[model samples]
Target: MRLIISGGGTGGHIYPAVTIAREVARLSGNCEILFVGTKHGLESDIVPKEGFAFATIEVRGLERRLSWQNIRTLCNTAGSVWNSIKIIKRFKPDVVIGTGGYVCGPVLLAASLLKVPTMIQEQNVIPGITNKILARFVDKIAVGYKEAEQYFTRYKPDQLIFTGNPIRPEVMSAGRDEGQRALGLDPNKLTLLVVGGSRGARSINNAMFEVYKHFSGSPHIQILHVTGQNEYNSIVSNIKQAGIDISSGGNIIIEPYLYNMPLALAAADLGIFRAGAVGLAELTARGIPSILIPYPYAAENHQEFNARALERHGAATVIADKELTGSKLIATIESLVENPAILSTMAEKSRESGRPQAAEVIARLALCLIKLQSNNKR
Candidate 1:
């Protein structure tokens, strides 16, 4: 199987594409996978490291407001489409899969125009602008949330599938004891994992300071906080200035970033983080109940919708970014931690909401589509 998987801009989009590509390669022993993304996207850095052939096209997302810059964007998009056409002609992929990002626009459209099979995976309840536009053109639409189907009402039922977000396999396979040992935490204590995506969240970090203070003396609970690299120094300084010694705070472990996230997620009894679709999927897959704070500035405010979906399923709780405060956050954390029965129930519900095999499902679908196309040609 020859495949072109295009998606980028953020981990939310890039990781899913990478996971799907990996699965496709595993299923089809001789699969050739090429990743197309913009030069500036996170994929440019990540894809090559993952050992996939990577290509870049010059493309920029259109600004929402009317501006002169949009004229330049229009010109670039046209050029990108032409570039995509050339790439598609040369690669001759059996299928092109797009996980949501602006980069997907030109590449998938070019594939559709060239009469190649194409599919897109949307990672949020509310679709992004690129995926929404591509929905009419693509052969199949895979969504992370079931509620997302309502947005693509124009597409026939068979065109859409609720496969959930593709999560890293390590997250599913890591055991709680393994995770606890890796992170150097006691297996018997209630462990709380706090993370705010790859780049830390200022609001979440600030709220966590108070939560940290509240649990400073507790011996029954342990906290693992991943303050994004950029925010690490400032957060540490602020803690010191507040007269709190984080290093000596017996049960707390703080780091700028977590390299072993599978371990962190596996070890966590509860999680506090932003509700990007991928993160939510991992939490549910691990059966870890979370307190989600959706990033307010995300495209289409989709993070909030993602959080609400989990909340609706009784798997997690939502605290709007605007209303998140140290007091409120600490209170919510206390409520969940203090009640073991409720926490266990929420964990079970979270596990129920997970789709651990989403990557394999999408990979099989793409390969099946390729097989069908080959038969049609005969």
Candidate 2:
């Protein structure tokens, strides 16, 4: 089997595509896979690292407002459609899958026009513009949240499968004792895990600074803050300037980034982070209660919608990015830390929302689609 998978621009899109690729490779032995993504997305670095052949096209997202750059973007995007068609003709994939991003638009459109079997994965409660537009042509639609089903109500039932988002296997394997030892965290004190996605949230990093500054003398709580790769140095330097010693604090551990995120999630008692689909999925998968501050500028304000889904289930609490402050954050952390019983309750609820079999379900659906498409072709 030859498969072409297109998606990227964020970890939310990339990781799910990677997970499906792994599943395809494992189950569809000897299948040749190619990834199509933008030259600029994290996929350029990540796809090849996973040992998959990757090709890039210059695709830019459309601006919502009137601007000169938007006009240029529209032209480039049109050019990208031609570029995608060329790639599709050259690759001649048996199946084309899009995990949902602007990059998916051109590739999936070209594939559908070419009569190639195509699929898409939607990771938000409110589907992004790319996925929403491609739904009419997508042979199979795998959705992360059930709330998405209503949006695609116009589609045939068989085409819209409620397969939850694909998650990393490491998440399913994280263990409490192993995670604690890996982070050198004290087993007794509460460990608050702070993450702001892979790119890091400037607001979140600033909140952490306030956290360390206000609670430096408190030995009861330990913090493991991931400042993102871009913000790490500045955050560290600021700490130094404040005469705060991170290494000697004995209660705080700050990292630029974490490749071993499952371990970090497992070790954490409570989480403070953005509520991107991937982040929320991992938190729920690990049954870690979180204080989610959604990215205000996320497309369609979808991150808040995702966070509220978990919040409604009693799995997490939402603090809008605009309202999130150091004092409010610190108070929230302290309140949770003081009440282990409530934390336990929230943890249980979080676990309830986690569909551990999400990836496996998505993998099975992809296989079924491939088989159905193959049979139809024959």
Candidate 3:
């Protein structure tokens, strides 16, 4: 099988696209894959590293209100579609998939217009404008959140599938003990993993100083805080100024970034995060309950919607970014870690909400789309 997968901008979109491509290649045996994204998007950096043939097109997102920029973007989109069509014709993919991004807008539209089997993955509870517009054109939608169905008002029921979000297989395969050893954690104590996506959040970092002070010498719990690369030096400096040890003997372990994140997820009993769909998927797959502070400036405030879904399902707690403070974070952490019954309940709910097999499900659906489309043409 020959396939083309397109998704871009953020890791949330790019990771799922990568996972699906990998899964499809594994299942199909003799498969060839091409990844289409914008040179400016994160996918350009990521897709090539995954060992797939990568191609780029020019595309930009449209602004919501009437503006000269929106007019220019509409024209650019037309050019992107033409470029996507040329790529599609050259690659001659049997199936085309989009995991979610503005880049997918052009690629999927080109594939559909050419009568190729095509699908898009929507990863947020509140669908982004790009995915919403492409819903009518794409052959199918693999949604990460079931609640997202309400927002995608135009599609036929059969076209929508609740496949959850695709995650790296390593996230599921890593074990707690293995993770503990890898990250140098105490297996006897409850572990709290605090992260603000890959880039780190300034607000979250600022709010964490008191958490460090509060739990400095706790025997029952340990905090593993991934501080993100840019903010690490400042945070460590601040922590040291506050008289906390930055050495290995301390209860709090601070990291700039985690290369072995699957192992970290395996070791974590709880998490503090920024509600990106992919990150939440990995956390839930491991049954780690969390405290989420959604990014206020996200395109549609969709991170809050993502966080609230987990909260409603009893898997997490939501803290607005504006309201986040060191005291509030510490109290929230204490509330869960202090109550084993509540934490255990939340963990169970998180596990129940997880879809570890989502990658396979989406892969199967993509292959089925090809078969169905082929038979239709015959």
Quote each prediction's TM-score.
Answer: 0.98, 0.93, 0.98
- Across residues 1-378, which tens digit of lDDT does each residue of candidate 3 receive? 899999999998999999999999999998999999989988898889889999999999888799999999998999999999999999999999998889999999999999999899998999988888889998898899999998876778899999999999999999999999999899988899999877789999999888877787778889899999989999988887888664644678999999999999999999999989999999899899999999999888899999999999999999999999999998999899889999999999999989999999999999899888789989
Candidate 2 lDDT trough over 10 residues, lowest sum = 213-222
Tell me the lDDT of model 1 at 255: 92
Ranked by lDDT, top first: 1, 3, 2
List model 1 lDDT by residue over 1-378, tens digit each.
799999999989999999999999999999999999988989999999999999999999889899999999988898999999999999999999999889999999999999999999999999999999999999999999999999999999999999989999999898889899989998878999999978899999999888888888688889999999999999999998999876676899989998899999999999998999999989998889999999999988999999999999999999999999999998998899889899999999999999999999999989988988889999
TM-score between model 2 and native: 0.93
**lDDT per prediction?**
0.93, 0.88, 0.91
Between prediction 1 and prediction 2, the one with superior TM-score is: 1
Candidate 3 error regions (>4 Å): 246-249
Give the TM-score (vs. native) of candidate 3.
0.98
Off by over 4 Å in 1: none
